[model samples]
Target: MCNTVKVSPRKLDPEIRTALVDIAARLLAEHGAQALSTRKIAAEAGTSTMAVYTYFGSMSGLVRAMVHEGFARLERQFARVRQTDDPVADMLVLGHAYRHNAKANSHLYAVMFGGQSLAGFSLTEEDRQYGRYTLLTVVGCVTRCIEAGRFRTGDPLLIAHQMWIATHGLVNLELGGYLIDPVDADRCYDTLLSSLIVGVGDDTKASAASMRASRRRRRREVEAEPESVAHRS
Candidate 1:
C-alpha cells in the first residue's frame, strides 16, 4: 500500500495576489521580461512560491494577468474622459488617456502587446478578443466624430486603428527615449495628432483648435486629480 498525504493550501489572499502581480510588473519594467521568475517574484512580494502557484497557477499565468491588468488600467483611464460637445476634442482626450496609461505602466505595456517573454503560454484567440475590447471605446469615439462631421465618413474601426497606430508609434518612441524631453514629446505628439486629425478629414485649423481644447481639458483634469484623491481618502 502507498501512503499518500494531501497537503492543503492556504486560502488565496487578494492582497498577496495583487502584490505578486505588481512586483512582477515592476521587474519586467526595470529589467525586461526575461528577468521574471517565480522565485524572484515571490521573494519580492514577500510570499512563498506556492502563493504564486495558488493565485496564478504559474509564471506565464501571472504575466498574462499582468497584461490583462494593464488593459484594465487603460480602460479606467479611458473612462475618465467625459464626452463633451466636441467629439474631435473628446477623441484626442481618449488618445491622451491611452498614452498616460502606457507611460504610467511602462513595465506591462510591451507584455500586453506580446513581448518575447510569453514563453509558456500563447495568447489564445480569447486573449486577443479581450484586448480588442479596449479599441471599441476608440471606435465609439471615432463614430461620434463621424456623426458630428468632424471626421470624414469611413469605417470607424479602421479610422480607430489608424489613430491607434499613429498614437502608439509616437508613445512607444517617447517611452523608449527617442523624443528628448517631455516638452519635446509633447510637441511631437501634438504635431502627430494634428496631422492625423487632418488626414482623417478635419480641416487643419479645426484640428489645431481641437488639440488646444484637448490640452486645456487635460490640464484641468490633472489639476483636479489631487482633490479627487483627497475626497476619496
Candidate 2:
C-alpha cells in the first residue's frame, strides 16, 4: 500500500485578502453583481478559488468586507481634514473630502450604497452603523458651529443628516453624468453648499466666505502633495 501525502491549505496574507476584496469590488463595478463569483475573483487576483474561501469564507462575506472597506476609506479621508476655528469652513472641507473619496473609490461606493446589488447579502444594522460612524465627524463639526453661533441652534445629528442628504444627492447626480461640464458642476456644487449653509442660518456673505476658505485650504493641500510624496520617497 502506498502512503498518500495530504497537503494543507495555503495561508492568505492580509495583502492578498485586500487584493481579493478590491478585485471583487472592481468586478462588481465593471460587470454588476451577476458577474461576481469566487472563480472570477480568484482568477482576477491570480489565486485559486480556495483563496476566496480562505480569505473571505464566501462571496457574500467578501462583498460585506468590501462595503466595510469602502466606509473605512471614507473615514480615513474625513480624518485627514484638519479641524479649524471656523467650523463652517471645516465642514465644507469634509464635504469636499466626501466627494473625493466617492470619486476615488467609485467601485467600493457602488457596493456600499447600491441596495439592489446587495439584495441577498443581508447587511445588518451594525454593518450600516459602520458607515454611519463616518458621519460623526460631520456631526462634531456641526456641533462646533452651533456652539460658535455660526449655525442655528438645532440637533447636531439632524443638521449633519441634512448636510449628508444634500451632499450625497449632488454627488450622485454628478457621478451619474447629469452634471456634464466640470466647471458647471463645480459652480453647482459651490451653490448647493452655499445654499445649505445659508439655510442653516449662516448669512449668505459668511457662507460664501467659508466656501472660499475651503477652496483655499484644498488648494494648499493640493500644492503640498508633491512635497509630501517626496518626503515619503
Candidate 3:
C-alpha cells in the first residue's frame, strides 16, 4: 500500500477575502454574473481556488457578500457627507454623493440593484434590510428638513423614499448609457432633485430662484477660470 500525501488548506486571511470580493465585483461588472466562477475570481485575486470556498463557501455566497459589501461602501460614503444648516442643500449633497458612489462602482451598483445581475443568488431579507438602513441616512436628512421647516409637513420616510426613487432612476439610466449627453444628464438630475424638493413643500419660488442663482454663479466661475489662468500666465 502506498501512503498518500494530503496537503492542508491555506490559512484564511481577511485581506485575501476582501480582495476576492473586490475582484469578483469587478468581474461581475465586466463579464456579468454568468462569467463569474471560482477559477476566474481566484485567478484575478491571485489566490487558490479554495480561497473562494474558504471565505464565501460557494459562488452564491460570494455574490451575496458582494451585495453586502456594496451597501457597506454606500453607507460609508453617506456617512462622510457633511451635514449643514440647510437640510435641502444637505439632501442635494447626499444625492450627489449617492450618484458619485454608484458611478464609481458601476459594476457593484449593477449587482446591488439589478436582482437578475447575479445568476443564482437572490438577496435575502437581511441583505435588503441592510440596504434599507442605508436609505435611512437620507430619511434622517429629510426629517431634519421637515423639523427645520424647510420641507412641508409630511411623512419623512415617504418623502425620502420618493426622493430615492427619482435619484435611483436617474443614476440607473446614466449608468446604463441611456443618458448619453453628460451635460444633459447633469441638468436633468439637477432639475429632478429641485422638482422633488419643491414638491415636498419647500417654497417653489425660493427654490427656483436659488437654483437660478447657483447656475449664474457657476457660469461666472467658468467664465473667470480662463481669465484667471491668463492673468497668471
Candidate 4:
C-alpha cells in the first residue's frame, strides 16, 4: 500500500493536469513535500479543495504523479546529449549532465534520494522504471569506451557508481560553498576526471593509443548489465 497526494496527474482533468503538475513541481522546489497538500495546491491553482480531490483522488496519488514527473524530466535531460561515436567523450558528457541536473534542483534531488516523506510509498514497476534510461545510457557509453580500450574494465554498474560518486561530489561541494572563490566547478571537474583517466593506467602503457586499446580489450571482457538499469531510484 502507498500513501498518495491530491492532484495526481492521472486524477486531474485532462485540460488542467499540466497546470496541476507545474504547480506541484514549483511547490516541491519552494516549500518541500510537506507543503503539497490539497489545501495548498487548490489555493495556489485558484480552485476549491474539492476540485483537487476530483482530479487526483487522494494525496498519495499526487505524490506518485510527482515522482513519475520528476523522472520524466530527468530522461529529457539525457535525451539531449548527442551519442558521440567516441565513448570516452560521451562519458564525459554524461558526467556533466549528472552534476548539472542535480545542482539545478538540489531540494528535489534531496527529497528523491533522501526519502523525507512522513508516509512511505512503494513505487509500482511502472513508476520505478522511470528515468532509469539516463543512467543506463551512461552505462552503455561506458561499455563502449571499455570495448574501445579507453576506460578501465570492471562491472558496468561498478564503473557507473564510480562516475556517480565523482560527479555527485560536484553538487555536494557546491552545496557546501566550496566553489565560492577561484575554482570554476565545471573546469575543476573536467580537469580532475582527465587526471583520473590518465592515472588509471600505468607507465608500461606504450602510448594513448595503446592505453585506449587496452581499455577496449577490458570492456570486451566485462559483462553487460540487465536492461532494467534504466530505473533511477
Query: Once model 4 is optimally superposed onto the true structure by TM-score, how far is the C-alpha of residue 188 displaced, in angstroms?
Result: 2.9
Report the lDDT tens digits of candidate 1 across residue range 132-171. Answer: 9999999999999999998999999999999999999988
Candidate 4 accuracy as TM-score = 0.67
lDDT of 2 at 180: 65
Estimated TM-score for each candidate? 0.87, 0.87, 0.82, 0.67
Worst 10-residue lDDT window for candidate 1 reads 1-10
Comparison by lDDT, 2 against 3, better one: 2
Q: TM-score winner between 1 and 4, please give it.
A: 1
Which pairs of residues collide in candidate 3? none
- Candidate 2 RMSD to the correct structure: 6.7
Off by over 4 Å in 1: 1-9, 180-183, 220-233
lDDT of 3 by residue, 33-128 (tens): 666988877766666788788888888888888788788878876766667666676777677777877876676787786654465777778889
Candidates 1 and 3, the one with greater TM-score: 1
* Total clashing pairs in model 4: 19
lDDT of 4 by residue, 28-143 (tens): 76776677777777666666677655665666666666666566555655555566565665565555566655655454455454332623655666665664555687678768
* Runs off by more than 4 Å, candidate 2: 1-9, 180-183, 220-233
What is the full ranking by lDDT, best candidate first?
Answer: 2, 1, 3, 4
Candidate 3 local Cα displacement, residue 152, angstroms = 0.9
Report how far off residue 182 is in candidate 1 (Å): 10
Q: Which lDDT values do the candidates have, in the order given?
A: 0.77, 0.78, 0.74, 0.57
Identify the leading candidate in terms of lDDT.
2
